[model samples]
Target: MSESARTHTRQRDDASGATTPAVPGTASFDRLGLPDGILRVLREQGVTVPFPIQAAALPHALAGRDVLGRGRTGSGKTLAFGLGMLARTAGRRAQPKEPLTLVLVPTRELAQQVGEALTPYAEALRLRLATVVGGVSVGRQAAVLRDGAEVVVATPGRLHDLVERRSCRLGRVRIVVLDEADQMCDMGFLPQVTEILDQVRPDGQRMLFSATLDHDVDQLVRDYLRDPAVHSVDPSSGAVSAVDHHVLVVHGPDRYAVTTEIAARDGRVVLFLDTKHGVDQLTRHLRAAGVAAAALHSGKSQPQRTRTLAQFKEGQVTALVATNVAARGLHVDDLDLVVNVDPATDPKDYLHRAGRTARAGRSGTVVTLVLSGQRRETSQVLADAGVTPKVAKVRSGEAELTRITGAKAPSGNPLDGGPVAPRPKNHNAPFRGLGSTKAAQGGSAGRPSRRTTEARKLAEAQRAARVRRGG
Candidate 1:
């Protein structure tokens, strides 16, 4: 059968044609016109059944129609678009700077991950895929386009840069997929997304998938999608129902200690902090406690972010300290624990952060640290998200914290109820652009604030001490 006919048949048979099913296995990939070579690669990768998002959206996506898929993290949206890319781009004619398909994501990590997910399927069709995101040389990406890439997975900013430089063009692009649309909106990339979409061929197929259909997401659908099919899956709580939720009320001082215990787990631990500085400090503390860890935020270069994720995925780093940038598009399977170092302000964020672990029907724990002052906000989040967390006073360095979070034992609390390690004042380190010329001028503009200077000095001192110890 033709791809569009097959997809139409599958959609007609689906009870979730209009509404997304809250469960998986409603529609098989084969029914969605997934080519044999793609199926073979999927089998080799051990991805047999489709997730709910995939089951609901694949048919429409494969049928050459715009689709808006609403599903949470770990709901298998990546494969949904991957299948679409493979089906649409296979046997298509294309040239350098003219890709048949494009996938835009919020972060570099997600760009790489989406690229990885689509690579095998594309390869099965004798197609090449290129990943273009920030933190890497634009010349390299321009060269990749010059060399010819069938599909491109990229972040909006980097892709925009390439377009502005006339290194690539999407005039002939047949398909465009935006993964984690809400997160892209949350990161203030909606304008960029719109710009990129505008540059694409107006008649091209488009699919936008996200966890919640917020105002920002709604805007994209109205602006970019044409007669789009909307499919939402089991939206009772969040995208992931497999996660167990917990809210621990701890003293402000003990928060760091509690965070460290959770970070020192045997399996993969994703800890979400509120700020870049906090993540950097937490990463240092966790590493000093002998836990293999890395940090993901805008502070790190694109290459650094990529390497950190690779290490975490390969088990070289068991714990990953991050901000919200890693909360949405990051798909690390079998993550044992997710610690919300800071309370979530929005109901959607609560759901997305907790969804990091407990993916693919696997049991995982979601522990949110609630300071006394944050009780009100925390309670509001749980109520809005329809989750009742186990609330109790827990010490960071205690076994109860580990038991609640499913984290393993640590030899000792690295902080010992002491001060959290400070970030360093290195000329090489990146700053958050705090309206201060000191950062821009490197040490010449002026001295940083007392608090800032102290933190920087502490970081430098720690590094010096580490060097002295031959670490």
Candidate 2:
């Protein structure tokens, strides 16, 4: 960002607000019609101010008006709708197997993240919150629902499954939230989403919030939301001003070398690839080359995915190589870089990947390591995304690569599958079993290279991931 542009950009903690074009003055939670308890909680959390989207939509939402909110990821969309639900449903009680408020997200990761984000306030308001998602113990989730939860955060598929089993009911659901609606559509969950929405109380309040508002998402707005007060804090754009975008064109042979260098950069970074197979492949290579890298994709068990993210946030893992699962809902304070080892297949994917950084008013960089073969198509995708990135033709061990990404040579001692050298910070990152990048190169217990065995296991588990698209 230039000096002139820097003056116009405002950053908000993604846990609070997202980076956005500057708006005049700041907005406070107390002035946004939040209940006294929520306001007190916000202040206690040091969040006296609300993000632009939150400031704009909370009034209508609290007034029982349907809301159609539009904002990029991390722009405080969670709290914008969350506070209203928590406030409006404050004094309500839910019967066994029936929830009063429902939040439907696209993926299991997102569902879990939202539930975690809202848990504190829900507790403050005496609401029991249940997170329903796939890949976990459905029996436990059913038990929670059977015991009754005032709020349920879920993915469309699992929630639908629960409904089919008669373990849960939607009749009592008075407030419905379709968060990341566009993603639900993109992931082909529209049919299931609409089915679930149909089962909810007909005249209940509805809110649809997303980064983009086209395609199947529009269908949802037309069919479900009634007379919504639409608020768009940031227009859908590929080139967000807060992030410095770059495309480093590299030779095919040096692609991995360049990527390894960037992952070995001084700070923590999220590296994106399009496929689970590719993510695992690169993760193995990075670990073998001595960088503390971890793989996050549908290939791993849900527990593995959860543990890996916790480690990454706590700095036990320096490099996270993932598919779109980590693209949204994953938040790390002060993460200044996101790398596209493989360019996104579309414009929306690009924006979501870029959103991982430049958060909370902090300036971040998104770097794409492009091969010669992919340059043209990648250019078209970026153009569609409205990003005119700084294009650089570079190689490994070069000054320009170092300048752009702070790339450095790997230690080459191979991580040996043990934990990375910890870089713990002040934040309260969760404690987990903490394991990623496999054991030392030699086989343990008849398993050839532990990293190799893990990689094979991942590849085997994900052989059909590209086709099935598991949550």
TM-score winner:
2
Model 1 lDDT tens row, 1-471: 223112221121123345332222345666656889988988898877787667767777777878877766676778877787678788875698888788988888788888887888888898889999988899999999988998899999999899999999988887999888888898889888888888889988988877777787878877787767667666636455667788898765455556666776667888887889878877766776667778899989877888888898889988898898887667786786888877788888888888778776677888888878788889998889988877888864467876787554454434334553432222313222212234455665455678998999999999999999999
* Residue pairs whose backbone atoms clash in candidate 1: 258-396
TM-scores for every candidate against the unseen true structure: 0.81, 0.83
lDDT of 1 at 408: 47
Over 4 Å off in model 1, which ranges? 1-26, 396-399, 407-409, 412-471
Overall local distance difference test of candidate 2: 0.81
Count clashing pairs, candidate 1.
Answer: 1
The residue pairs found clashing in candidate 2 are: 11-361, 12-360, 12-361, 13-360, 417-438
lDDT of 1: 0.75
Q: After superposition, how far is residue 334 of candidate 1 from its true place, in Å?
A: 1.3
Residue-level lDDT of model 2, residues 359-439, one tens digit each, is 756789999878777889999988888788999999778899999999988877667666443322112121111122223
Q: What does the lDDT read for residue 449 in candidate 2?
A: 75
Candidate 2 RMSD to the real structure: 13.3
Looking at model 2, residue 409 earns an lDDT score of 85
